[model samples]
Target: MQKCGLTEKSPGQYVDTIATDAYVWYEENWQHDEYDHSHQRYQLTYVEEGYQYFHIEKKIYLVPQNHVIWIPTGKEHRTTSEAKTVNLMLVLFKSVSELEFYQNVHVFSAPAVLKEMLRYASKWNKVLTEDTEQQIFLQAIQNSLPHFCKESSGLQIPVPTDSRLIPICSYINANYQYHFDSDVLADKAKMSIRSLQRIFKQETGITLQKYMQLIRILKSIELIDTQQFTLSEIAFKVGYQSLPAFTSSYYAIMKTKPKLKR
Candidate 1:
């Protein structure tokens, strides 16, 4: 996604609010590009299946299955997914208050109930009001969203202000899910414990342990949200030996539990 002034440019026309929903988009456009925007009535998304990649405010991200990209109000952001991806996206303008809480960007897992609503909302163009079936699905979607938008605090690691942590930061951003620890990371940065620790937090707004925890939670969210991984599998995958500790930390950050679908 490239950054620009606010305005979404799409070749196809979308459903207007009176017709069914404010908008319901389900299609594949490989070379897709959306113009920038300051704010909108509502923005929500669902990843049916596929590998989702996005670069919001210059930071690259992976949005996998059961993923929801909720762009609050109008924060200029752009995104695209590759082939082999099936997604359901909806924009509701009539009810949501006009407020954008995120100044930068955030990536969050779509809760289970919202995932089900995406499945339902994808059924028709404006089935939301038609009472075709699951008429309450819209309410479910709205209710499931947080009353006050969360600050852009999803899985994000700070870039070292010191400039020395660049290589290591890149590695961690690229390999957060892989098995590695501070010693290995320190080696990658060509620094020892005390030096790396001092610079890492000063630049990143977090300690090494906290930073690793962020990586662990991020990897876990991707697995739990997109790939079909049991929490136990995710814990091990993120280098957590004790499942209970990982669970506690995950909840502290996401405020949600991990429950993968069968």
Candidate 2:
């Protein structure tokens, strides 16, 4: 087996270039580079322990523990983790059958059976050849993926690509913990309030207020995972002065109230 050596550019370049049908790559306490790249094979990233952030274009998706992020073939994206102690397992497949689920990026639940399968498959760090039991096993896992991916994590937020709206999105992302007013946002975009509303919706397909709410909820999820703050504290930290208002907004997007882990 030819092991991939560390490169100054990107540690994943070696594995990404491998010419194989199925491969498993597991990392513990891994720190990723900021470089953006794409893979030829379809990739399934199982978050074995901590959260893995997937970036595609201007959107960012957070895949937490017991969840898997499916990245289709030829989709350019950047993946990184923020946890000090994180475990991630990557399963890459080539020549896979085209299914609706496999056509786009998704962050879905990883079932218990799939988790066990991934753990067992982690032993085979390199490529698995065809007609062998290893390949057969991997094929079974691939077949079972869609069944386990029925629901998404709903942790993604997209930034607008329009030059006029770019600074506006950046400001919301940076200052999500603060209340945003239409006047402030319009001023930030250097446009009138009416034009700002129209152009922002046309560019992002969501209202500017809705976009800010989504960012706030997304940030709240990250803060909730740390388990250091109470639910009220989290609400305030994420720009909600009233706990009920924060809870309402969170439930509206997440379909559940904000609660801290005991």
Candidate 3:
């Protein structure tokens, strides 16, 4: 595995092939380039910090901090980072039970114990020397897999396919600080207000306003984790007129108070 800083121009990347029965473990602390690729072995990717986006089958899914994304074999996907520095753990191994829990791409929350196990597994990037140790690590991870399936948190929002609605989603993501109304969003999508609402729901299975709120809360969480901005600043930055409203919405979605760590 190579260790380097990733930039917008040149992002760091690593790929390992599962020749026989092998499990590859590595951690990447940099942004990744966007490209469509596939591997023969099952992949379990955990985001330790920062955010990552995956574009699969024309839909984009946001993988936030402390989240895990499971990609099955032969699934062509493109990945990119939403932040400048993204710390990610990549585990590639063969598992017959890959489709037992999830058939398509899935994301779940990574509990503290699983996080430590992944960190421990990151040491075996090149090869596992001891068969007994490898079995122990594999058993530990498999035992914890059922818990992950039960505690799966679907934190992803699928990008719409309608060309008209694409700009509206992009506008909200880029200018999330601005107060938006359905009229403005309808105008951007070049549709009537009712049409906009109906189509957004049909395409994304979420109301426009609710989707915007989800975006705001997720963005605020990212900002809060950075510890670079105060809660008030983050509130305003994500388009809340007041801190109370921001806090209320944060609690509604995240079930916790928004705090900025110094």
Candidate 4:
């Protein structure tokens, strides 16, 4: 909570770091909220833990661990987290940036070094510099980024044509209010539990349970920010059955408690 707090982001409001093309915020307790973006900005998010959904181009992308989702300039995008999520952000503008030569979604196994670099950035330490030395450090990250990943071939999931997992996925999407487990998901997907687990990790880079958490976190975030329900109301709405469990999960994802206005 000490490191993750109000400085990161606040509901219905946005922070502008006018001085630097880079901005980073780690909400140790970065809770759920839907935010609208304007002008043009690109983001590289490392999901330290928890779940997140990116609403972009009429598609919903579930972002999980070692998992990074990048949104390019002028793209209408929104982010919501259900778990206590550690968010490492590298936001840049088209003008002051060198990433223009690259485009489209890039997903690679985040290198241990890049993970360390992002860890440094997400520290919420305000002492970062655009100094010649610091610039090289940052550039090293940017230059090395586009190469680690080849083109996606427009596939987010690696489900085989013969895979029967779609039915299970559809059921989970429809019944997210209920608790999900590997056995249940496997039954629904009509694959052996072990195979379902393997394919899920291969396809989404995370387990089925992780994806479910992302969905719950997204639902909780929407309700909390919109005030469509009281804390307890949203808790049960997202299948927590209790406020403490929901809060615990929320804080676990965001690394901070939801600020209640007096």
Best by TM-score: 2
For residues 85-163, write the lDDT of model 2, one tens digit per residue.
6787888887687678788887877778988898888778654444477788888898888878766545776667889
> How many backbone clashes are present in model 2?
0
TM-score of each: 0.57, 0.83, 0.82, 0.50
Clashing pairs in 3: none
C-alpha local distance difference test of each model: 0.58, 0.77, 0.71, 0.58
Task: Show model 1 residue runs off by greater than 4 Å.
Answer: 1-21, 27-42, 46-54, 58-67, 72-86, 92-152, 157-163, 173-187, 190-195, 224-231
Best by lDDT, which number?
Answer: 2
Q: Give the candidate order by descending TM-score.
A: 2, 3, 1, 4
Q: Kindly list the per-residue Cα lDDT of model 1 for residues 1-262, writing each as its tens digit.
A: 2211123344322223244434445543233454333444456655565535555553445555655566554445455554344444554443453334332244566756666666666665443355635435665565566642343364454545465787887777677666676788888888897889888777766787777677677667656655556788888888777788778888876666666656
Ordered by lDDT, highest first, the candidates read 2, 3, 4, 1
Worst 10 residues of 1 by lDDT: 1-10
Residues 11-109 of candidate 3: C-alpha lDDT, one tens digit per residue: 323343334344645555655447776656566778877778787785666777778887777787778764646788776655545446534677777
**lDDT of prediction 2:** 0.77
Q: Is 1 or 4 the stronger prediction by TM-score? A: 1
